[model samples]
Target: MQQHLLRSTEENLTLKTLCRKFSNGALIIHENPVRQVGGKKNAPHLKTTAYHFDVLDVDWINTESSFEADFVLVTTLNPSVSAIYHQRATLTLSNGSTYTPDFLVIKNGRPTIVEVKPHKFTVKEPWSKLFEEALSICETVNVRFEVQTELQFRVGNLHKRAEYIAFCARLEFTSEDILLAIEEVSKYTDGMTFDFFMRITGLPKILILKLVASRHLYLNDALEYEDCSMIYSSPAY
Candidate 1:
């Protein structure tokens, strides 16, 4: 993949520039935040965190709040998401104000401008109008716009499962183990329960959960992680 570096000196790069670079199949890199995250004057109420997803190929991705952190974690686990950039661009709104979206996500080769916020704030002034302008601008550039909130992240133990899988992914594992697990699951055709898979593979649960985290094994997003939870082999295998 081609790589295009956006240095801190180029923080004022336009959205159209980002779109064009992405259209040319270049990996976009912005190593700085467009706005302050959790400074005392900026967002004292929210906690800040940094995360790294190997698939994104970035050293660290920083987020201002736990909500944004969860968004990063959940999005990183998605099989379709190809890349994620935090505070990637600064856009000029129609009202002469500027806006910086929380994330720019590349999924299935399409660029999506994502804004993470609490559910209550989405309906409030300034934010509502700002999102409207952002959506309008995105439409002109042929990019999709999305608003993600706690409601979406907190659905049906999805966040809990994502957290568990991420933790397990950090534990020791190997390509051979992943391959062996996938080979075993591929035989089931209709998928199998988690407990049954563990019994058959003789691989520990951590390895199995690691597979789920890395998306080598698929699980129902709406279901809680349990012995009975169904697991399927990724089509890639």
Candidate 2:
């Protein structure tokens, strides 16, 4: 989020608020985070994840649009065209390759072509819609785009992103909801490495890990490690 006007007061947000704030070009980030936010499959572990996810949302929903364009969309899909797109993946356009948009927003007005780009310089552009639409009034065509960071877009809405991730991780899980989300996310993902968890799990990983550490692993005197290198470090060889 940027240093701009304030709209939120003391009220908690609803789903519609989430939809509105994160609608098209909003950027969300997980403030302080950990690798296990999205992984680990214990009952106590998930509450931790949920908490952090909420924190990210607390930060995210407060994001502001940039004064200058960081990511630009020069669309020629025809203003007469109206459509909604369902997305499934984040993208980073390879050099000279075309950029794929993640989702489309059709409101009988000008288009935003919904995409979720990184708040950092990790990519040149966002990816395309993951699924196909059966609606005849719509067309799903990929396009090329460019990104030039005009300002540092805050990952404030990330807390909301975390919540959404945790929820999606557990849909149809049919168990202790939190743990189920954990189990689903952990096992469903293969070659589960810590760095991979960092990117995929996002913020809930921090919240989830904290819950696990304090409740299950840490509990008493705040079990602390100086660095993540300690995780795989052996006892002085």
Candidate 3:
């Protein structure tokens, strides 16, 4: 319901100021905000959704309603994200209750607090209140805040493209392997088909995919993985 300057161009962040913002305002429940002091269950099969990212060493996902959007945020969005933590920061509201956001993302040296809730639930009662507090707290630290839902996640074409890229990112490639693959690719001045490229490079499909993930290979405008006939070198290479 409320729109914030979600992404700011300001670089006025410091270790002291960042600490002070969290210290001054909202109480961050570090140990156990949930504080479940009940009986410890044994071997419970949690029904939470799990997502794995090739870029991240650990799997961080939500079993809750925001799983889909959260998955997209980690894998599909910008590749410049330096790190991601799930439920690592807690925000204690004015009412003495605390809320743990879905994710804390550090991208391009800036922090962003992200809340993933379905769009239909955004205008509802309690979530609206919590999100407002989240916005206020995030602004105090000069960190951007975002609320993502199905609308942003369900774009047909972009979602497919992102899925392909993310899958490629997970494929393992060593530095030496990448260099050798690129050197082979460098010979194709006029560009080459997906299959032909794979054949000449003599790399596994997964490793070839990693080339695309690392931007050594560029996708044609068609954006069709199956119909992707042409692959060119990224200018960055």
Question: What would the per-residue lDDT of candidate 3 be over residues 166-233, giving only the tens digit for each residue?
Answer: 67776667888888777776777877677886676676655555666655665554344552467666
* Each prediction's TM-score versus the true structure: 0.82, 0.19, 0.60
Report the lDDT tens digits of candidate 1 across residue range 66-132.
Answer: 7888888888877787667778766776656667788877777667889999999999997898888
Ranking by TM-score: 1, 3, 2
Best by TM-score: 1
Q: Model 1 — TM-score against the truth? A: 0.82
Local distance difference test scores for all models: 0.72, 0.28, 0.56
> Per-prediction RMSD in angstroms?
5.8, 20.5, 8.5
Segments in model 3 whose C-alpha atoms lie over 4 Å from true places: 1-24, 27-46, 49-54, 57-77, 157-177, 183-208, 212-237
Candidate 3 pairs with clashing backbones: 48-63
Superior by TM-score: candidate 1 or candidate 3: 1
Find the 10 residues in a row with the least total lDDT in model 1.
1-10
RMSD of 3: 8.5
Greater-lDDT candidate between 2 and 3: 3
